[model samples]
Each structure stands twice: as C-alpha cells, then as structure tokens.
Target chain A: MPAEPPVLEPQFATAEQQRSASVLGMWVFLATEVLLFGGIITAFLATRVFYPHEFERAAGRLNVLIGGINTVVLLASGLGMALAVHAAQKGQRWATLTWLGLTALLGLGFLGLKGYEYFADWRDGLVPRTDGFDPGDVTPGRLTLFMLFYFVLTGLHAVHLSVGLGLVSWLAVRVMRGELPRAGATVAEVVGLYWHFVDVVWIILLPVLYLSGHHEAADLHF
Target chain B: MTERTVSPVATVLTFAALVVLSLTTVGLSFLRMGPAGHLAVGLSIGALKAGLVALVFMHLVRSPGRTWLAAGLGLAWLSILVVLTLSDYLTRHVLPS
Candidate 1:
C-alpha cells in the first residue's frame, strides 16, 4: 500500500475565514501589545510633566545621532516587511521571498547596530550614573535617572526586535518549504502587522527619548 | 498584498522613497528644534512614513472597505488609550516643579 499523505490541518474553514481570523487575532494581540507599551509611555509622560527640567537635562546626555539613525532603520524595515506580505498575498512568490529576505537582513542589521550603539553607551559611562558613572554630560544624579528610562524603553524595543526577527525566520522557513501558502497568506500578513506595530512604537520612542530637548551644545557630537 | 491596488515596482519604489524620507527626517532632527518642535516634526514624519507603508505595502489601500474599518477601529482605540492616560498626566497637580 502507498504511504499516507501529510495531514493538512485546517485552522479555519476557508481562505476567507483564515484571513478574517488572522486579522482579528492580530488586532486583538496588538491591543495587548499597545497597552504594554502604553503603560511605559504613560509613566514617561508623567515623569516629564512633573520633572520637565530634569528630564530634558537627562535627555540631552543621550546620543541623538544613534537614536535618529535607528529610527530610519526601523522605519525602512517596516516598509520592507509590509512589502513582503504584499508580495506574498498577491502570489508573487519571488518578490515575496526577496522582500522577506531583505526585511530579515535589515532586522539583523538593526540589531547589530543596536549592539554597537549599546556598547558605545557603556563605554561612555552611560550605565546609570548612580552606578558611579560620570559621562561629564549632565548632573550625574539626574543623568542616572534619565539613562534608566532610556534603557527601559529602547531596551524593551530591542527585545521586541529580536522576537520579531525570530518570527520572521520561522516564517522564512515556511516560505522555503512552500508551507506558507499564497492564497492563505494570513500568517505572513499578521506577522507583518506585528512588525509594523513595533516600528510605530520605535517612531514614537526615538523623538521622545532622543530628541525631546535641545540646548545648543558647545560641540555637536554627531 | 493586493496587487490590484498597486504594482510591484510601485510598492518597491515607494518604499525606497520612504526610506529616503526617513533619512531626511532624521537628519533634520540635528537642526535646532526646541523640545516640542523636535518631537512634533520627527513624529509627524514617522507617522507619514508609517501611513505610506501601510497604504501601499500592507494592502490597506486595496483591502476591502470593511477591513479598513477594522484597522481604523484598532488605531482609534489605541489612540483613545493614549489620550485618556495622557489626560491624567497633563492635568495632574502637586508634582515637583
């Protein structure tokens, strides 16, 4: 007798059903992710409202150049990720794979650059001034608090980026195996949605954390 | 991924242009902007870039009207969350000056 064919598990009844479910599930998941970051933003806003001077003084010590570049990198990655989904949904397999690969490559590039920037921060003595750091940029005491927020927000975003890359890698494997179907491209679509949401978070974060204040510096670092 | 709304080349090129836009936006941040001005412009550019990406790349433009509605609802609710929480922060009294 012939061997059994692989059992294809039907997550939903039809392509339309899958698409609808995927979109709905992604939207709900995004709601939760929004609240997660929402809490962080709320805390930041509260701190800023109460201690505008202190926050500004602290923000000034951050590397605006790195933050700005990161914003562009993430935004571009979002675009690429969206395009990947677009290509996939339309059954343009080659374009889909190309865009997907580009997206993943860009994601990895961002992580690499982020690592380098983080190292630079440590070298600059930005590891919480309360931990006996003195970067000679701001009041050591307040600077410590500022770095604390900086690490918290961007660090979390970085963690999200890693998770996103992992997701993309898994999706890529499916694509390679032809398991990621063109007709039912819900998984790719939803993953792209998650990716775009993360990018939006970074867009808001860069300005708030890096460029929130401006007092003319004697020497522009970037 | 709706090909009907846009072409492959169009999507890729638009993304390229947006990449350029993002670079310019970041570059502008180095110019002197008071705190609020800096955030306002930078975030505006970010929002625009995001919108373009969504419209062209995410098939939001070509998606059925109802899908767009679902998306709008999602974002609206998200904005509500931000605004409501922010109201408290903005209106709070008795904090260090």
Candidate 2:
C-alpha cells in the first residue's frame, strides 16, 4: 500500500480520488459561472430582437481587427496554460514555471491590448451619454444601450482575466518553491480550468460583440 | 504512474485549430449574410471554439462522468432559461397598456 499524498483528505482513500473530487467541484462551480454570464447573454439577445437594426449598426462601430488580435492572444494564453498543466503533471517544476510564466505574460498582453482598445473607443466617443458621443446612424439611445452591453461584457471578461492572472502567478510561485509537487498536479490543473473558462468566455464574446455588426467587411487581401 | 496528461503536440494542434477557426468565422461574417445567418454563423463558430477549449485545453475530455454531469447541468439550465424566455418574448403579441 503506497502512502497517500498530503492532498488526500481522510475522506478520500487515494490521491486519484482526491483529484477527481476536486476537478468535479471545479466543474460544478463552472456550471454556475456559465449561468452568471448566460443571463446577461440572454438579455442581450432579447434586446437585439427588439432593435436588431440598431444593434447591428452599433456593433459595426466596434474595432474587429483589435478584437481578432485579442482572440488570438487569448488562444495563445490557453495554449501556454495547457502546456503548463502538462509539465506539472510530468512533475517538471521548472518547465511548469516557464509555461505558467508565459501564460501570465500572455494574459497581461491581452489586458494591455484590451486597455488600448477601450482607450480608442473612448477617443471615438463610443461611451454612451458622454459629451462627445458618436451615434453613427443608429439611434443614440439604442446605440448607447448597445455600447452599454459592450462595456459590461468586456469589462466582466477583463475582471475574470485579471483574476486568472493572479491565480497563474500564484501557481508559478508555488511551482518554483516545489510546493505543488507535494500535492501532485491537481492544483495546477484546477487553476487551468478557471483560466480556460475565462478564455471560453472571450471566445464567445468576440463573435457576438465584434463580428455581429455589419461594418464594412474586413478586406483579407491586405 | 496514472496521470492522464494531454500531449504538448496535441495542445498546440488544438490551439492552431482554434485560431484558424476564429479567422474563418471573421471571414465568414463579411459575406453579407442577413442578420440571422450572420449571427448563426458567428455564434456557431464561437460555440465550436469554446467547445475546443473546454474539451482539450481544460482536459474535460478525459474528465470523469461526474464532471461531465456538472458541466452539462449548467448548459441544460442555460438552455431552459434562454428557450423559455425567448419563447415568451417571441410569442407575445403586444405589451400591456
């Protein structure tokens, strides 16, 4: 009989049991998270049903190029996170740290790009009810509502990204200190679930917020 | 001896597929599909990308049935909320005075 790892509570007979319990707990939590964002998405859809043209026109004003770049940035971050989990499972502490560091860096880069995009939107007077508001052809009030959704959705996603950064940073430090090996790889894998959940949110947001608007089609030839 | 870890190559491949699909969705959005078609294409692709991340990057594919149940429950509830709400709003003839 091999000794159980420290991560195994007395309630669990084996490390594998402990890991499955923890992972299942995370999934349960994520299910609630899906609804947290789902409510807002449902509301957005309902609003669109009433003002489809205005919403589409409002969406057109968004910067799709920047959104596309951010999507790629987020996807790259997911890749780093996945690799980090792989390294952690292999018990390669330094490799785990390296990959996790890369993940956090990419996450920060995504935030930077998001900040710049927000600033550009501010400059374009996209913020509703501001003195320099630009409503384009869309009704100002309805456009404001659309922009409201944009800010709220992206802002919520940004908050999640920041939380993920904190989590990844903490994981990296633990990896460097050789603390995570004692617990096996469950901690890192759990954190990866949260990180990838955030990425999934952004993946959904990109199309709804950035691509739905009928702004001029992006010229791919360039 | 019993860890179920995804390969780095497989992770990289999944990332590549996600990126390519994203670009394809963006390109498809430019095709002047009417609003319904446009949204359907973009959202369908978005769902696809999200599924990839959940399954591969999050390692849900190898996860236990309990985890799948938890995840599925969330989506099932979301569907109930969305469908019920849409049905109510879409079928309503007029607002109360």
Candidate 3:
C-alpha cells in the first residue's frame, strides 16, 4: 500500500507536530471540563459533610442497579472508542467504522438506561423543585438538596454524552465516505479523549452518588 | 504513531480492570461503614478508577509532558477548591436545628 498522505496544516511543521498540538489542545479543554464538574462535586461534598445522615438517606433512594448497569455500558463505550481510534491509526476503515458504531450504540444504551432511571426517580417522587416533591422519611430540605445535585450532575453528564454521540456518528460518516484518511486519525483520537473523560466523570459519580449511602440502608435491613 | 497506539491487549486489560474495580465499589458499599467511612472508601476507589481511566484509556501514560501538565493542573486546581471549601465547612460546628 502507498504511504497515506499527511494531513499537516499550514502552521504545523510536521504531521507529528500537528497531532501533538491537537492532542494538547484537547487536554486543555478537558482540564476546563474537569474544573466545571469538579466545582459542582466540591459543593456537593461540602453539603454532605454537614448533613451526612441526610445525604446518606437521600442517596439510598437512588437506583443502584441502573447506575451499575450504566457504568458498564459507558465503560464498554469507552473501550469501543479506544479501539476505534486504534483502528483508525492503522488505516483500517471498516474496523474504525465498526468500533465507532459500537461506541455510539453503547452510548445510546447508557442514555436509555439513564432515562429509565430518571423516570423511576420521578415515579418515586425523588425529583425536587417541583409540585410532586416528596422526601419519604428523610428531611425534606436535605433530600431536596441531594436530589438537586443528583439531577444536575447526571443531567449535565447526559448532555455531554449526547454530544459525544453526535461527534462519533459524524466521524463514522466521514470514515465511511473516505473523507477521514488514515492521517486524519488524530481526529478520532481527540474525540476518544473526550469520550473517555466523560466516562471518568461517571466513574467518580458512581461512588459519590450511589455507593455512599447504601451501607447505612443495609445496616438497617440486615 | 504505531508506538503511541495502545495495543489491543492492553486496552482490553484496562477495560477488565475497570469492570472489576466498579464491581468492588458496589460490593464494598454493602458493608456497614458509617457515613464518613463509606464516603472515604467510596471516593478512594473512585479516585483509583479515575486514575486508571486517565492514565490508560486517555493516553496520559504516553502523552507528552505538556499534556501531563494540563491534566495535573486540573487536579491541582480542583484540590485547591475542595480543600479550601472543606476547611470552612468541616471546621464549623453544626448548630442543632
């Protein structure tokens, strides 16, 4: 096979230089994303520290089965994305498309499960800031605060995942059309970085939101 | 680029590790640790999982120094925010409502 033409831009000295620059730029953007979610999480932690029991009680009401399933789904999606990038780097167009498709499907699966979880939360009256707000046995004020954090965190994450779905789909289309040549694999790599970062956020959230309160409820039960 | 690309075997192994760690987090949650203990352990495991994802799947292990700097800067700033904020809340006595 002939050497794939390099996709070097005007300013970049070489293809490798361009790839590094793109990766670095993505990292900087991801750094800002870290601060965005990090700030919210800090606020949640500060509140939890003050009202640990309340937070625990509120957290116990969360659907752990759904959360765990979503964790696996998102992680699988991340793996697919990594494989997609790997295939792209090797100039395997069909493999790249296949992995990207799988990644998007898994992402959609995560969102579908999340939507179901949200529906369950609504039916349980766990959602706050609305007319149907109910805190069950926990203090209304604290449960409301916890639910707010839960919604905001998960909702923001869902939005990001939706955007990721769009990006992955777009890339898949390009790959199918032969527009994204092997040299342009850096595009897939950068998108993979974002996908993995979102996965990282969900991983942190699993414990912070789901696992923190389960032991208390278990203690009461058994 | 070939050198930079993570082998399929390594990627699969990282995925398996993440799955096991996630299950462990769930399993640990069944133990009767108090709120503080639960939070500590949960977040600790979470941090570990996050580190794995960052180092391997995110390519930080093979990333350039500048990329590592960017990642480190994010964590450093997050620490500053959390520590400063917690210092105030954790030190204050909760007035009984």
Question: By DockQ, who's the top model here?
Answer: 2
- Model 1 C-alpha lDDT versus the unseen true structure: 0.71
Worst 10 residues of 1 chain B by lDDT: B1-10
Candidate 1 local lDDT, A1-222, one digit each (tens):
122233334865565665666676775677677778877876776667766766666666677666666666776787678778766666556677788888888888888878887887887777776764643554567667777888898889989988998888878776666644443356688888788778877867776777676634442454
TM-scores of the models, in the given order? 0.81, 0.93, 0.92
lDDT of 1 at A210: 70
Badly placed stretches (over 4 Å) of model 2 are A1-5, A130-133, A217-222, B1-3, B93-97
> Across residues A35-78, which tens digit of lDDT does each residue of candidate 2 receive?
98999988988888888887887777788878888899999989
Q: Please give the lDDT score for candidate 3.
A: 0.86
Candidate 1 segments exceeding 4 Å error = A1-13, A90-94, A131-140, A215-222, B1-6, B92-97
Local accuracy of candidate 1 as per-residue lDDT tens digits, B1-97 = 3433456687768768777876776566567766667767776876787677667766677767766766677677768877887787777664645
List of clashing residue pairs for candidate 3:
none
Report, to 2 decimal places, the DockQ of model 3: 0.70
Judged by whole-model lDDT over C-alpha atoms, candidate 2 comes out at 0.84
Clashing pairs in 2: none
